[model samples]
Target: MDWMPAEKAIEDVRVIAAPEPRASADLEAQLARALSLRWEEVVLSIGRTQMLSTSRTGLSLAQRDRLVRDVSVAILTQIDIFLERKSDRFTFQTLLEELADEERTSVASKVGAAIADVEMEKSGFRFRANARELTFEQFEATQSKNIPDFVYDSGRGDETTPSDVVAVEAKGSLSRLRATKSRLKNLAKKAYEAQVQAFVGSTANDSIAVTGGCAIAFGATPGNGDCTLRLYVSAPAGGTDSGGAGAAVRGPGLGGARIPRSLSSAANAMQQLDKKHEIERESATLDPQANGNGPGHHRPGRKRRRGPNAHGRIAFANYETVFRLCGAANAALMLRQCLDGAVEREDNPVMQAFYQSSSDDRFLFGGTPFAKCWSPSGYFAIYKPAAEAILEALAANRSTPPDSVTLPELPKDLSWEHGAFAAQADGLTWMSMVRGDFTTKIWNLSSGKW
Candidate 1:
């Protein structure tokens, strides 16, 4: 017969770990006495049962049986309690219901209310707000991971520059209260990972804070357990448990982009949406400083002329000046409020159309792409000559004598097909045939050849 070593039996096997195991003072006293005795004597008494072994270290048969029974009961009781606590979370079906309702009310309501409030303003601002509800319904539409009770967004106005947004979550108890508290403490570690996977795909914006602080208000219901509500707020810059330091936000870092195995594809789609806007904001910031050659039209602090002919000239230049059209320094400042007093619309289909089509070509006419671009050649094509051509056409339409006009030409060696594809790691490829030319490329290039 196979046998386990006595030492192995004692390995990491503590009898006092459970509360009940240590509950009986009488049993503890007996255990202490047993431990205090010499090992050989105790072993002889329990194992080889001779007169010498029994004389000073023996127990009567009834006493031995009673001790074993009590200890076993304590151990089993403790195990049962642990198991019960572990299985205490809400049912998946119930959780889903709560999450769906919360999203419809809490997050979705906030977005709709904000959009409506902006539209009712009487100012001379021009703002278009796209209030989207990233509900369990939408998540289900993507057929990705179970919907998280959080959301993200981007906003802009004629008076202010575009920026990102993050919202709260109401995930019904994934872990128990004690367990969740512990997990929350360690959530800062996810900040870096969240930044990359959440924001990098959405044109490299902030990891759109999908889940954050929640303000839960408990109701007066009897059988609902202890329904204590809480308002969990996000730390200003301290980040979540799994988040890294602020360094992750400096630029696109490798650590930020690592996708954990636990992530679902649905979350990935949401992230891409965020990236599209980030690219737009970055591209908008690239507009040139001035529009004329007059010496009086120089940038804010640069050397320029104030015509001695009694013409007082003041010029605003660069992104700092242009960005003020949206708002102050706060990126999340509502777009409508920034637009002084103009037309405002919620779910502005016109603006949405612009966003949908222009996001990928943000640098069009600018001389370069944003630093975060994944495609170098494509960036050059749109931001350089393509932009110049469009600007020339606009100039020709607006004025009889165009200031300076130049037409864009396709590179002689590069065909339409060459401009439309991308290759990634693994053999996963993406192709676009929208415009006559068929372009295809792999999605990821790190794994191997495509």
Candidate 2:
């Protein structure tokens, strides 16, 4: 059995920085510095008492800088403790649990404030009241806490001034485990209500005032936490800001925001989500030939499966490695779905060939790796039929296939070539392409076979 090193456990983490105001440029900088604590010595605090303790070690200078940057006291301490305990070598799943623990408090606030500020600056808007003391009663009675995250209006009194306005509450953390659904639900509700309050207060008398939208993010999940960061967003609601709580914004609930931790590490996961939703929604309105089309490509319909044996098992590594090499549609995905359907349905040639061909290095290793199958030519034969079918469908320029033809089934291997198209300089095994059909172009990373 292969052993994974502790450092490789997390691989990397992608955190969305809460947006902060351009005006708070000074405050943000200070806050970032203060939290990063690069300048300050690590001090242990217990309630009102502060003590300098050197016992808590294992923090590298870079690690300390990151702690300062994340502005998370709890996470830093936890990480230090992790190193001290050597818990970093725990299973990947366990590491996520640890991360969740680290992000419960200060990290949340820091992330929230930063996000709020960036959004404000981006839209040339300002928080009506930031961290402004609002007594529970004052917040409720003044109804000032119900504002939407953002607001846009035609004009208040001055016609020359831009009416566009925005408000966003940024939240972040390093916690791996997530708050309970009930708790998160309640938080979302309160936050939404607060957003509405902000919305009304800002729009006040303006008839054209509009609440842009809202967002949320944390290290926790609606999805399995494999250190996969996800985001969710909603379109700005236009029209007059109706008095009372504006319609509550909805989120993906549990499964959404699959952002990897590479680019935009500091961007609020929510912002990434909002941007994605925006793209999807906009694409829905466009014609296939429009300049801005959704992931416009055709594929054969999803194939039905009978059982696991009916479809052959696939090594996850091989799937991923091949996809990287193919540089087209998801190589791994195509393999799994096709194999699953073949096995389940007990298709004679496909299933037999799949099982036979999948032996050797492919089965021994996980996912799609660089290893070749027992029979490359035979494997190609089974794969080619599907590939040709897919090409034919794409060439036909169809979005959804007709009921007559079966859809492409999920690949037997769960691996994907998604990150495989990245620049060679990126130095990662996975390649990533920003725009293109990642599944179709099967460029082999090893032999540079296209």
Candidate 3:
């Protein structure tokens, strides 16, 4: 599989701004199709790699296949279900609230259980496959504990001992909302603090040890109606500052992105409309025609048609732009985390060797892997490099290059298998391949291994 370039990906996103009924319908179909294709591309690509193929992990080929199918179906089903009942005006929070508890559980469990084999209990805390084992939750004998939405306990295989755990807090929000960066940071901090508290409080039980935490924000972008999954890893708490860890791991926000322009323009346009309405009201009140039978009075010239739904159109465009920007930023952050995690873990000797020889440290963002290979970000990150590569190719092909390009940052920390990387990249590439401007060199690694 080859990767789509960034330019083409942006163009695909632009389709969300297309007019009316066709835009909404096309967006939904594209999302489902893209997600399904990406899922298959990931499975097949990883299946051929020696790293995953020969792993001692209990996941067999059949299990992997089933896992992919079940999880993808669950995700698509939930999305479709949400869209079916969505109102003209709804927020990401609204969608989240509307989803039944069972539906939410299905989404969380399918992803958690398949990737790490974690099981959710009726109590809302997740555990490993073993019955006696319980993933660490903030256990309070008197009151409800502030536990994460999902916890994956990598148990030590000894029932008496505590296992390292990964805690995930799931959140949903509108991509166009204000202060998203702060909101996400706060959410991640809260989840991380709860995990630390649970780890400390559960010392008496000796059941689970908190290793890391993740915050997964599922944002619903309005225009194209696509969902953006942003994953943030919580850094370990340092000193007395509870937020230090979160601050360290905070993902990039939509700074100076085109989203702000869209929002500003929309606001300005709305203000102009409001002023026009106010002027009309005043004019009508002062008009001689209102007094009846003024010979010199003539009907006011018809106001230039602004169309029936001009405001609605502008608002939707703004929402779509914000969603697209946030989604891309989220994807970039996830990819950076994956590359950094793979490099830092030193799981692959080849990757480790490359890191040792590399002079640049910017490639590896400092953080511990929350769930290693099973982390959702790792899978998502696989698509980043390829996407960027394709975008680069497209930019180069243009008669006049773009003033700026927004693409995921390439991972510098690890040596990649050409086929594996290409396959992963293809997951995103397929989306933009229709541009007909890309080249095979987009997948080739020149200069260094990574």
Candidate 4:
């Protein structure tokens, strides 16, 4: 494993500053479109319940059903399709005990990842794309190198000017044995190095912007104690590399910002995650083709352009690292309709507009870091697939949805009622659910916060 002394960890890993107003507004608009697209897709899900989604799934519904059927017959067990839906929601003994050890382990992993995602959003980073969705070939081409979990929108470029993005790698660990802050420090530093190697692609940005990755880990379901978090901002690929790990340390409020002994809860998370851009050297070097089409090619960053000391080259480093800890997408998902009929479930028109506006079509959905329902105030998809188009529709078009981008019926009852799930950077903080019914049926994912 990579090695970084305790003193260096304190000096190097740090939080980023908040995004500029323009970038924030840009992301907000993109987020609105993304959430709007989800509304449309969910409506379609209602329509195609019988159909099997053959797209991005671990198992087809039919396959799963067949597997269940085989297993049930072999064991003389009845397959109750509605067992989950019909089961007692108020079953006190089965709050989470129903899961097997392995299942719990898997869930614990996701929960840790989800909490990390929540922390990043709470800190102000925007998810752009998920690397896992892409194929190996596609991965190397469209996504950033080193395969950081998700790329942030970068909020820097436009149709004319290609912008850069910050590629982040998520670090999630189940603290099985007695782990210490010293150990996690090296992991964070290692993540920083991964971020350094990442080259932003997708024809959006030429060079990367800001440090990625934040160093934070979560306790496993059976683990003990709070985890440490060092939100490090590393020297980006295009940015100037700090001479070494011993460079000067800086952050949004470096002198004032107190490094947390551990990110024990949401209360400790920074209000607005903003960071200064100290990378040196300017200009996005274009590829030989220079057509601005396809995954445009470009060379790696040149020699270290004297940037700030903190944003320098170090042994272990980069993120959408505790940026921490964690984070994480798709399309007309095709479907096999009933009655042996092949239905072309038309893709969302609103999404079509958004996709049409996008230069890269690899992304199917917006990057949402947290689980189904973990955002403190709740979270929404924020990647801007159709940013410019949506802006135009809202501004000039006379129609309610601008003719091309009609929105779905607003969502309802998506939030938890008292005992859903509350999380922090460390892990799933708590779970509660007195009743399963949602009486309010309110649509919380509106325009602004989304």
- Listed in order, each prediction's TM-score against the native is 0.18, 0.26, 0.28, 0.37
Residue 127's lDDT in candidate 2: 16
Give the distance in Å from residue 307's predicted Cα in candidate 2 to where it truly belongs.
61
Model 1 agreement with the true structure over 1-450: per-residue lDDT tens digits: 011121111111011111111111111111110011111112111211111111112465335334433432332232222211211211112232344543423322222222211211111111111112222222334422222222222122112222223222222122233123333223322322232123211211121223222111111111222212112223223222224332221111111122332235534644774686456444443222222222212223433211111000000111111112111221111111222222234252211000111323222111122122222112112222322222222222221111111222223242234234321110011222123222332211111111
Candidate 1 lDDT trough over 10 residues, lowest sum? 308-317
Candidate 3, residue 248: CA error in Å? 1.9
Better of 1 and 4 by lDDT: 4
Ranking by TM-score: 4, 3, 2, 1
- Candidate 4: 10-residue stretch with minimal lDDT: 307-316
Candidate 3: residue 349 lDDT (0-100): 27
RMSD of each: 31.4, 21.6, 24.7, 17.1
Ranking by lDDT: 3, 4, 2, 1
Report the error of model 3 at residue 320, Å.
Answer: 41
Q: Which tens-of-lDDT digit does each residue in 1-450 have in candidate 2?
A: 012222212212221222221211111111111011110111111100100011122554335333432333343344344321322221123343344443435544443343333323222221122222111332445533342322211111121233332333444443434443434444544564455323322322222222333333323331243322222223223321223333222122211122222334434544674586356334432112201111322222423221111000111212222222232323333332332232123232121112112222111111232213211100111133333323232223222221111112223342323222111110111211122311322322212122
- RMSD from true fold, candidate 1: 31.4
Query: Candidate 4 — what's its lDDT?
Result: 0.27
Cα lDDT, all candidates: 0.22, 0.26, 0.28, 0.27
TM-score winner between candidates 1 and 2: 2
**Best of the two (1, 4) by TM-score:** 4
